[model samples]
Target: MPFTVQYAVPMTCEDCTKSIKKALDNVEGVENVDFDLEKKLVTIRGESAPSQIVSAMRGIGRDAIVRGSGRPNSAAVCILENAQGKTRGLVRFIEDEEHQIIIDCTVAPTTPQAQQVSIHASGDMSQGAMSTGEKLYTLGMTSKFGDVFSLITRQSLPLMNTIGRSVVVGPPSGPTTESLAGVIARSAGLWENDKVVCSCTGMTLWEERKVATTV
Candidate 1:
């Protein structure tokens, strides 16, 4: 299970988040972390008991208090990997009913060249705009939690649309003989004519196939 911790600290910069993350990273059994500066919230994952987490946070010189017992909704985590099963990067989609989902980028343990990300959707994205139809809005790496939260509340895009929109993820290396074959296997030629859209470098055919299947 996941949990959240709220703290009352003077964290005026990213450096503060980084410092807290570094401190938490030193604790054993921690798995993942997501910190928001404006909300002053930190979500952490671990297999250990909650008491241990509370103690660890206290050791970091912050007044930490448990805030929630579960992972936040509409948060989708994409784990990118290379041919040898090495991690590459993370692409997270945070959705809300008021605005388009925001995407966040983070480096994974392994980076691949020529990597592609496929997005599968069931509903039409054309209702918003021509480009908006196929292009799902995702927060850029530089996105801040406060900014994204504001956008979500202002626009009113249903969070459920993300699950229904036809998965349009890609950046598959053009229509090469081998890459085409992989797409055929996964998308059944639905994306045969679509252009590769990902910006990852050095991604291999196997990785592309894997991404196609996953998306």
Candidate 2:
């Protein structure tokens, strides 16, 4: 899985340029390299570790660092299905870095109530129903067909871990009997929720936005 990364480096001569070029070329996962003299920027397209790229530049005695990234270089998606017509969801995994992945999730809300959605070990919803496989991550959806929720996992794991897996949307089994209690339960620290999820992500819920979109 390769993505693009740009870097800033200080080079005064051809020797400096060549040295930096050669250094980055030798990196284990770097696929291609192009240097812009005017911008002093280097764009690399590969699976090279960001740290490794910076280290390579430093090895040439040139102080270099990353420039800009607008999106993930690599990605994967899951097609979520629900039988009760409660909601449908789509979860995307965006590249955070070489070692980590960011979750970009969208769901179509059918029921006004919040549902517990997540990435599971398998996509088969028929066997034991929605809760069939091991629940990998708990997801939150406030509005159905609109805004996307962003969650960052600390694992820095590869997307290969999700290739054949499925995303499930269902009711949350919570300790407290309340609306969206499953979500609150997750925040309260139950199940395997904290291991993969690092923190609370900025996302929109129906209640917050209904004020603006309401008739």
Clashes of each: 34, 4
RMSD of each: 15.9, 15.4
Off by over 4 Å in 1: 1-10, 71-215
In candidate 1, how many Å is residue 114 off?
60
The lDDT of each candidate is 0.37, 0.48
> Candidate 2 local accuracy as lDDT?
0.48
lDDT by residue for model 2 (119-140), tens = 5666454432343467776655
TM-score against truth, every candidate? 0.29, 0.39
**Candidate 2 residue pairs in clash (backbone atoms < 3 Å):** 99-156, 100-156, 107-144, 109-144
